[model samples]
Target: MVTDETPMPVLFKKSFKKLPMWDFEDVYNQDAPLRPTTCAESLRNSEDESFRKAFLPNIRLFLHKDNINLTEWNRLSHFNNPFGFMEYKYADVMASVKLIPKPKEPLLLPKPGGDGCVRCAVVGTAGILNGSRMGKEIDAHDYVFRMNGAVLKGHEEHVGNRTSVYVHTSFSITTSLYLFKKYGYTSVPNDEGIKYVMIPEAIRDFNWLEGLLKGEKGAGPYHNKWPRTYYAGQYNESRFYVLHQDFLRYVRNRFLKSAILNSTHWAIVRPTNGAFALFLALHTCDTVSAYGFMTEDYNKYYNYYFEKGVKTKVVFYINHDYMLEKNMWKKLHNSKIIRLYQRTDSGTGTEKPK
Candidate 1:
């Protein structure tokens, strides 16, 4: 029912206005079980070939401004403004940073092997992982990507311990530290050799990036001491990478393309941090399996697995079209683009199209 003609907020108003907010009691009720539609079934009935074709060509995974150069940057910047299209300002920020560290060697996106497929797992904070016991399965992949409040101490039995990549916005990194005890996120994933991918979701992120590279607090948010402990390990060039504004714009235009972009609320149409992480995996890895992302039965589970007894509903903030994201995930799964973790009566299974 979500079409380009219908605005994202209007769709939400029509479809989800009356849905009940989850209560604490819902967590104790064992009657509700996951009943996800099988990927095979969805693929068999899919009619959106045009959508698939649109995003298949250019999967701009990482932003090495050196490779993209200023010419391409200008072209893409004018094409569509991802984060409000302040190219001159963005360039200024980039130029101000003296040493922007890059990975010593490029990411092993195409692993040296027969098929050269890099298997990756993109983990979200959804509560469906509570008793899934998928920890071992998720960690078995070549790379594991986690974002936001990725609390792993007590829930390692379900969420795994290996974190190859930690994706975050400036807000998420600072907020995670701020709300450490409240959300039960004891620590951000600080394993040695782990890569940090920063999504430049706002101007604050650019400031934070400059501060991080300079090893000093900036005038922007997080003016307090930079939490260097979370980024443990020798200062290496390869440890940090920022998402390009052009790539983000491409994602919005090709995949999400929410009607909010054309309306007065252009800010709200931008993709969520989780969507950025998932798409990052899709482009970098040959095979991607998303766990804890919003499923069709998203309302049945809490917004986060770390919330013990409070069955909080996954809030669809004015900024994100969560329903549209859910549909995109489903479509990608059906098209064999990525594996979506789906819980059914039989147990948890990765949806791979035939």
Candidate 2:
């Protein structure tokens, strides 16, 4: 169970206790142009080849029946553990739901152009996007990934309108509907080619998948009122995907390895939904760029662009070590593995671009 009061381990206690300090000047700077910088040359010159090579495998991003031996379900059961540290019997769940088979080719394989690199943008909901005017830039990418309450109706100028993929958990989808009118989440992007990526964070997601596959909001958490229109009318099996458990575990262990995972508070130390989407792009795209994610001056922006009132500081949730994730993004940026959009005194600068 995720709780607001969960304690951080002693090793991370001090780091977690530092209150956010806002950079009001940077937040209000409207003339800043989004410039991208690359560290590829420097990273290549560094002696971290092995450190970088370990992350090059696409299999580290996800587990598919084609890539892993599903027959060894018993030995792999531990990977199916949910965010709350509760074990799930994926064997029975997998048998019940006829999952869409993994695509033979990577979804974001580069097409023949500009060095044949597949450029991707993982858009977050941070408040810094308010006047960033990054829409056209984001849409220019070969693929775009979004999640949660991605409000893009009126703010298309700040955040792009195209969505190649939308990632979410069952709870996120249901809650978006519950707060649709209030939060202005008018619709999930209805582009015909947009794929829905499911993060099976809990048992309810399994039930939700069954409902989605049947084309009826079957009996489950949504009480039969789950919107059928949210998904494609004629179900295309290829468009709906459930993230593999092993992939999620690999990410937690390698990239965002929070100290809390070793303590009794392990149940609360899962990655945020944003981290999952960002890393997913890393493996799928030739070049990945993250937008509206937390930065060193995170307190300068609102939690979300659509939020109204005095700028609210980003909250430190027990379920996510956001600081650690922020540092992870920085490290990857330094390694030229990802391009992270960050605020600079002069303007916005990104990790080394190709």
Which residue pairs in model 2 clash with each other?
37-352, 38-352, 38-353, 39-352
For model 1, how does the per-residue alpha-carbon lDDT over 93-199 read when each residue is reduced to its tens digit?
45423345434334445444535456789999887776778899999988999998898887787889999888887788777866757766656787777888878
Q: Where does candidate 2 have its weakest 10-residue lDDT segment?
A: 25-34
Per-candidate TM vs. native?
0.76, 0.77
lDDT of each: 0.64, 0.64
Which stretches of model 2 miss by more than 4 angstroms? 1-53, 60-71, 83-86, 89-92, 112-114, 232-235, 345-354
Question: What tens-digit string does per-residue lDDT give for candidate 2 at 117-170?
Answer: 567899998877766778899999889999988888877977899998888887
* Residue 96 Cα positional deviation in candidate 2, in Å, after optimal superposition: 3.5
